[model samples]
Target: MSKVPANEDFYKVHLLNEWSWKLTTPLDAQPHTIDGNHIFEVIFEGNNTDTVCANDGHVELKFAISAMEQRNPRMPRLKFVRGLSTQFEFAMASLHTNFIRGRFGLQLLFVSNESVIPGEDFRLESLFSINDEVTPGIFEMVNIKLGERDNSTTSTLKSHSNTPQSSWPTGFIQARPVCYTSERYREVKASRDAKLSKQRTVLNTSDQELLLPRTLPYLFYAQRIKPTDDPHEVVGMRLQNISFGTPGDGYYAHSSFIVWTISFGFGEPPIDTLSPLLIGLITLSAVVVLGSLLFGTMLILIFQRRYRFGEFQRLTETDTTSAVST
Candidate 1:
């Protein structure tokens, strides 16, 4: 048997990042059906070849809901299950009592224990992976605004400190690792210990905290689903507002990579409707056109008045000259 080339290996690993999934509800079909017992199915299909290997690799699925009473829970309700093999179903009846008329955020995350080996590096880049691409923040203190807080009270805070304490952004809750095997767990422990051992000096409490590593357990892929045309539909309820990424962070450091939005409760996926961004663009174009017309009319009036005034001055000069000659 011939050994696979490096390029071929890279291609195989790249396929793992190319996987995608979709959400379909009964409301999506023709003659839409939506009730209290409605079910939302996620169809995940992807090519996973043998060349892509991780020690304890698996995928996870999560669904987050936001509505009136429980609006903006610190952490979303999560479901961890084997991903990319088959269709997964979530019965709305099991999760909610009456019917949840709110926005749904569906996320898929990939977790693996393949990075513990020292000197043996695994390429961390993925379509869904979120990490700093350039130099990390240079400043010790960064000023940020938390939700609805007075701008005057906003203060400069440290990004990461060597102290015993740390501050997370608003609405962010700490989470523990969810999926892993015993062997992987041991390896992670060993690797963490080895890394910490190198820093032997007993420095200040802040210095110790600064030496700690920030570990992101999962890399995510996400989508937002909004309500459909029908008001009675159980799925695709109206969304007040939806947002992706973390506040003050340029990218979604802990959140999922948002792909796009999907609509349900309609017969067919309606044409990608105009977005608020598009509407704003159209309004701006109209304003510019009207402003240009008004400016042009004003310029024309000014030019006409100047021409008449010059003609009157010329006529007055000619009359004065004739009088002088007489």
Candidate 2:
């Protein structure tokens, strides 16, 4: 296992063998934008090593695997894809976007040439804080939450028993949501009262019908509010309330709108969908370039052979003319 980086900014995260994703929107006509160009770098050290890494350049991996897991979950086994250190980058893009409905969902696709290990799915809850400030809900924002397992022991075992050996840990982690409303703006603010404090309405009314992720059980969101005279005006007075976390089989799996995406990959050739789509696009582009080179080489060879034959005929004709003159 690699030592945890000393810098506080380098947070530890857990990646499961499975992949999951989600996207949410505002309740009304709130402004919103989503860019899924995030990257996940997985470094593997093990007995069978065949990985790719670099001191400065981007490390290219043949196949990568990742999944949503609670706290820093344990990965007891890892395979090296190349002789060098293995690193990877995953990209994000979507088929479409919706403003009126205030809802968006992420699609999951994985590709890998390596075998995968079993693991748990969880949210990275440890990063959420109560002291973070607030921002007015005028538009929407989207961010990624990297998860780390709370304990290494809380993972799947390689036993013959069909039943689970132990229960999963307590919490899940989540990234902050984009809140747009009538009032102020504060970044990275956490609130204890996610629902009652200053909850932002989901932009899409239709999305109010969907369910949350099955792995996340709790629901926590923040809001910015201005006190008013009427007690019942809590919904109107608050500037923003952004939803964050939910427990497994809880309100999240039952929520109408949720915004998040998961990227993962597996081990082996003919990479599985488990490989991220962003990566797939890159591999496809490479194949096209190689094909073009092969075709161009064949055309050049044919033209060269024809020119040589024509030159040989001209030489023969000149030789015959000289012989006739003599």
Candidate 3:
């Protein structure tokens, strides 16, 4: 019989497997523009080996931007979306300029896909931190804490006793944004309720509202920086935060993520004296050319009429002279 591996060896193997799931972004050490409509792309690749394909799990990615400190207790939480493939891309147009200028936190949560059993309770807690100063376009993900739990594990096993079974982990698979202001909170809640109503036809509506926690207990903080001298210049961003579950559970965690600031300058060019002056010159040149052509045409017509009149006068004078000579 084969002997079981020791704890150290087991953890090492697990790490190796986990490392196989690679996260990649297109920045390549370049700063991201803070311009409102930047496109961010992230790719997740996994080996199709048995260990990685234990249950054909998929990945979900989420992110949020918040100030380094919350002056308002009612800040919105992160936004999340499930990835259908290895590559995930989204536009950052929704990011508010005021919220992005300072030291803000950018939280990314990754989750594996799992079946949701009815009547089961699940929970998740995640935290990450940066080990060093993150410069514009330069940062790394370190100290990642990703965990989940499900209460219906034993019952689900019993129900599938006679069939082939594989253990699957289940828990919260998405992030919910927390809005600080009452008006914003109401707006978000109404949007969510509307979405839930539409999804009720296809999914269990009872649990849809419970998928995300209603409270904003965790505070995400970052160090704020001054705006750059140039509006179009890119800047560096450093983010830090602590996230945990209910107190006394000792599940607290901290993590850091970096964002490169970029600016695409989406609006029209700045209005300047030179622009107006050039436009005026061009308009004046066009008018002058048109006026010259009109005057030249009129002169030609006048010259032709005068020349015909002179020819008629000479013919009449010549006829009068011949008659007088006869």
lDDT by residue for model 2 over 98-184, one digit each (tens)? 222222211221111111122322212222322211222212212111122222343322323474533311211122243111112
lDDT of 2: 0.26
Cα TM-score per model:
0.25, 0.21, 0.19
Give the true-structure RMSD of model 1: 25.1
- Model 2: residues with Cα > 4 Å off, grouped in runs: 1-170, 176-287, 310-326
Every candidate's lDDT: 0.25, 0.26, 0.27
At residue 288, give the lDDT of candidate 1.
Answer: 100
Q: Per lDDT, what order, best first?
A: 3, 2, 1
Using lDDT, give the best candidate's number: 3
Residue lDDT tens for model 1, 56-125: 2223332332111111111111211122111122111111111122112222221211111112211211
TM-score winner among the candidates? 1
Between candidates 1 and 2, name the one with more favorable TM-score: 1
